[model samples]
Target: MIRKLALITPWPDQRTGIADYAFDLAHGLADVGIELDVFTTCTKPSRTISGVRIQDIDKFPGTFAFDQTVYQMGNCSTFHGEQLPVLFENPGIVHLHDPALHHLIAFFLYRDDTQDYYRVLRAWYGARVAERVQTFNELNNQGFWDSPHVTEVPFFDPVLEHATGCIVHSAYAQQAVHSRVPNLHIRQVRQAYRNMQPPAKYNDGEVLQLGAFGMVQQHKHVDVIIEAVKRCNAEGKRVHLHVAGALESVCKDLPDLAKSLGIENDITFHGRLSEEEFLYWMNNVDICVSLRFPTMGETSAVVSRALQLGLPTIVNNVGWYAELPSCVTKLPTEHDEMLKQLVAQLQRVSTNGEQLAQWRAQCRRYAQTTGSFEQTIQDYVRTLACFRTSAMAA
Candidate 1:
């Protein structure tokens, strides 16, 4: 039997990790003979990419672009209500992106169950003038407010009950789906991971280079990381920081931060890099620090990439990174606590050559064994195969 996959995500001119993952999945599926079509919110659909059929939604002469149409459906716009039926018309499996897509889906589930007679009567008598009232009534009606489909995903069991299967990035998400929707069938797979290859001489250096990977931002703890490095340098440690990435949105307080610290010369701002330059920077990085401060995610694609290239890393103990074996030091995001860990980790990595060597080896081993690109693709291949099974689709 021929199998087709209708992958829906934010694509075309894609930049994010998820976007790249979608591309990789589509490419891998094609390599194995699966028919794939991509519909995305990004650029107008192209007819083909790397041999897979890409439907340019622009050809539809529709109300909005593919992304905009689906975006509203997520927002619960009555206009967006049209896309769901169309999503079902595709002769393949539907792969949803993230949690934010639910806004529009909620309205459909509510209207499907427990009719609202009072609002119906009001709207029946008053058509054009009552548009606002109908929308409000539709949103406010308590009968459908907490419906299973609206409240939870696996709970919306029936909506996806027909879907071949669902793809999620992490074990945590898989557990969440199972715990919430035990009867639903799901295929667990790790999303693709990438890493930068740190040069072998990453540590055989005179100047200690600590990079913030982007402009100074609070979430990234750019300011705090700077302060910690300053403290370390004052304590006879020779460490400098190179802040890379495009400074598209400037942080408001970074100027005053440099002046107050009085170590402005110690830092080099690489502004923004073209795609080629950015990869070059990653390839040369001694340590890639991911500021997962204030929140935790399942994984960090950047961290994974650096590990692949044997780039030693110091990450905030957020996400699944706590499980990896490395010189990973978890510290409170507080300015004080961050300073202590930063200073200590820098001093150790600079002077303790043996320890730094071991940390680099750990990064290489962990990333190579678990996060190799081939392994990630294999996981998805097995997962999509399971979804393609006729029995599972039913």
Candidate 2:
């Protein structure tokens, strides 16, 4: 029975994956007749949807008159930090895009004072962890953000304690949230993506082209993918890699790494791409390689988009990616064997036209049958409506 909603999220103009996702979801919700108020920090709206009203987040007034406020949250501090006060002050349905929120929480709490950060950490995680803040900081300096303590410990309680409900995209995320906040209402919805026209006839060319999308980070294993491409070429297989994402961020050295390996010519870094350019590369590549290690129970929008477009994708068999359909080429988690497996798979798919076609058909079937944007929108409506009913009954 929800007629209207307030969506607190970064809008498409921000050019982040979460922003694009929220944009798509807003349009879907609006199409289903739900009046939506989109609260964003952007000075002007990027795109318009009939039933969605774009309002400056500064004008949020700390509360909403709508039935529910869906807050799109992720791991990035820059994008999600300012919204913490609103989330803490107004209880709403939190659409958690990433289960591990240590960095975001740390950045916000420790921005002004280190002592305040430790005090809050101790209050939420206890003395054992607060005392080891120095160690965590040292390890963080060594780029161990995905280590056991950071990824396993749920740093969400401080921010999500007041949330009325939560929606997660993967089973891994669902389990993580349920373990931390058992009493909170939780719903698992398949990540949403609209099916695009399937890519032009599968490329049967001799040289295999691979693409890696989204924010390129160490966890995404773009370096490993580069190594795999080098090895495949060395073994008499022609392979090229296309990387498109933020290059100025954590993995700025990827181009340098590619150069060091003498495969700079084989790899192309497209930096951050527009939506049209993203889809263009997705269609052009022979295969999409999206590998993640030490995952924070996060699902990839890139993988979802690839599958919906019937593009064969390769995923590492861990965390949320493990739950993907068999149509995707999966690589084992062990680093030693991973390269060999990837090289072998790339060689096989690039050389065999029949196998590639089967994977495409199967992936398209899964996307068409398992879940579509239409179904995802319906799931959101049903889940939101049920939240009110369940609260009343309780």
Q: What is the C-alpha RMSD of each candidate to the true structure, in Å?
A: 8.9, 2.6
TM-score of each: 0.68, 0.92
Top lDDT prediction, candidate number? 2
Which residues of candidate 1, in runs, are more than 4 Å off?
1-3, 12-15, 31-33, 44-49, 57-164, 193-203, 214-217, 247-250, 296-298, 325-327, 333-335, 388-394
- Sliding window of 10 residues with minimal summed lDDT for model 1: 65-74
Global lDDT of each candidate: 0.54, 0.81
Per-residue alpha-carbon lDDT of model 2 for 225-338, expressed as tens digits? 999988887777788999988864768888888889888999999988888899889988988999988788788999988888888899989878998888988898778788
**Cα deviation of 25, candidate 1, in Å:** 3.5
